[model samples]
Target: MQNLTTKLLAAAALVAVAGCAKKAPEQLPPPPPTETTPAPETSQPTGPVGSTVVPGSKEDFLQQVGSDRVLFATDQYDLSGEARATLDSQAAWLAKYPNVRITIEGHADERGTREYNLALGDRRANSAKNYLATKIDAGRISTVSYGKERPEVAGSDEGAWAQNRRAVTVVITGM
Candidate 1:
C-alpha cells in the first residue's frame, strides 16, 4: 500500500510539471500604416532630387523627412546592402541638385552605454555621409552623431532597435 501511494504521488507530481510547461507564442509585429494624405508644401527644390522622388524640393523631401525610412544593422555602423539600396534613392536626389547640401544624422537605440551609443551613431552617420560623398563632393556632405539621444520607435525590442540604427539625410539648403 505504501509503495502504491508513493507511485501515485510521483505520477501526480509529474503530471503537475507537465501541465505547467507551456510554449509562449512568437511575437508578431504589426504592419506599417499607409500614408494617404498629401504632404505639406514648403519650397522649391534647389538641387538634385531622388530618382523616385525629388530631394531639394520641400514636398518631395517630405516623403522621407521625419519619416522612419532609414534603417541600420544591430551594433553596426557599416551600411548593409539593404541599407545602401535605400540610401541609393537618397543619393539620386542629392545628385539632382548640386547646390543642395545634406547632413547625415546618425542615431542609436538605448540598449548600450550612452557614450558608446553616441560614438556608434557618429560612425553610422559618417558611414552614410562617406558613401554618399563618394558619389558626390565631400563638401556637400556633413555628419552628426545623435547617439541614443532620440529614439524614433522608443521601445526595448528588436523592432525599436532596428528603427534606431539609422542615418538620416537632413537637407540644409538648395543650390
Candidate 2:
C-alpha cells in the first residue's frame, strides 16, 4: 500500500510540472523594431537625389571650393599660380562660413630624409596658411606637417610623387 501511494504522488507531481511548462505556438510574432528599420512612406527623402548636402558640412565645403588641396613642385614650398587660385576659392568658402576653423596639412614626396621631409612639409603648410590668413582670420588657422609619412599616392615615379607633394586644407571645426 505504501508503494502504491508513492507511485500516485510521483505521477501527480509530473502532471503538475508538465502543466507549468510553456509550449511555443506554431508561428512566432515578428521581432521588435530596430534603429536600422526602414521609415514609413511619409519619412522618405523629398529633395532631388544627391541634393542632401548639409550646410556648413565637409561636403558643402568640397562642393563650394572644387578642391581642398594644392599641389607643390618637388622640394619646394612656394605656391604656384594654380595653387593660389585654389586657395582663393578655399578662402571664399571660409569667408562664407565664418564659424569654420581649418588646419593646413603639409605633405612631401618620399625623396629625402625623414627630418628634411618634415621640415619641407612644415614650410609647405605654412605657405598655404599664410595665404589664407590674408583672407580669413589668422587665429582660425593652424598647420601640421606629415612630411612623407602620409602620401596621397605611393610610388617611386614622378607621376605619383607629383600627386603626393601637396598642402591640404581641412576643416577642423565647423558649424
Candidate 3:
C-alpha cells in the first residue's frame, strides 16, 4: 500500500512539473516546390563593409567583405598600383577578422572570345588573390575565373566595361 502511494505521488509531481514547462511551438516548414534551390538566406549582416565584428551566429555570419576589386587594361593581369591600393584594403580587412575565408571571382569585359575571356578572368582573379595572400593568410583565399559570363554591371560602354574587367572577392560562409 505504501509503495503504491509513493509511486502515485511521484507520478503526480512529474505531471505537475511537466504542465508548468513551456512548450515549443511547432514550426510549419516551407512547402516543397517543383524546383529545389539553395535555401534563401537573409543578409543578416548589414554592418560596415570592413567591420571586424562577426555578426549573428558564427554559422550565419558570412559577409561580402570585399566587393568589386579592379582589373586592368585589355591584356594585362599584373596588379597595377591602382589595383594594389584596392587589394591593400581588402588584405587589411581579412587580417582584421581571423575566421573568414574567401573566393576571388575574376571577370572580363565582353570584348574577346569565350575562351580568351575565361583565361583573362583567371589571370585577373589570381592577381587579386595573390596580392591578398601576401598580406594575409594564404589559406583564407581561393580563386575562380568566371570570365565574361558574370558581369558586375552589364553594357558596352567604357563605364560598364571598366566594371566588368575586375576581380570580386566573395566571402564564403560557415567559416
TM-score, every prediction: 0.63, 0.70, 0.62
Model 2: per-residue Cα lDDT over 1-56, one tens digit each = 99999999999999999999999898999976532222232323333477885545
For candidate 2, the 10 contiguous residues with the lowest summed lDDT are 34-43
> Per-residue lDDT of 25-131 in model 1, one digit per residue for the tens?
69768866433232232446434554545444545655643341467778888878877777777776556666666778899988889999999999888888778
Q: Residue 89: error of model 3 in Å? A: 0.9
Sort order, TM-score high to low: 2, 1, 3
> What is the RMSD of candidate 3?
13.0
Q: Model 1: clashing residue pairs?
A: 45-56, 45-57, 47-97, 48-96, 48-97, 49-55, 49-93, 50-93, 99-175
Tens-digit lDDT track of model 3 for 85-172: 8788667556655666778898899889999999999988888887888899888789999888988787999999887888887766
lDDT of each: 0.74, 0.85, 0.74
Measured with C-alpha atoms, the lDDT of residue 88 in candidate 3 is: 81
True-structure RMSD, every candidate: 17.0, 11.2, 13.0
* TM-score quality measure for candidate 2: 0.70
lDDT of 2: 0.85
Write the number of the candidate with greater TM-score, choosing between 2 and 3.
2
How many clashes does each candidate structure show, in the order listed? 9, 0, 0
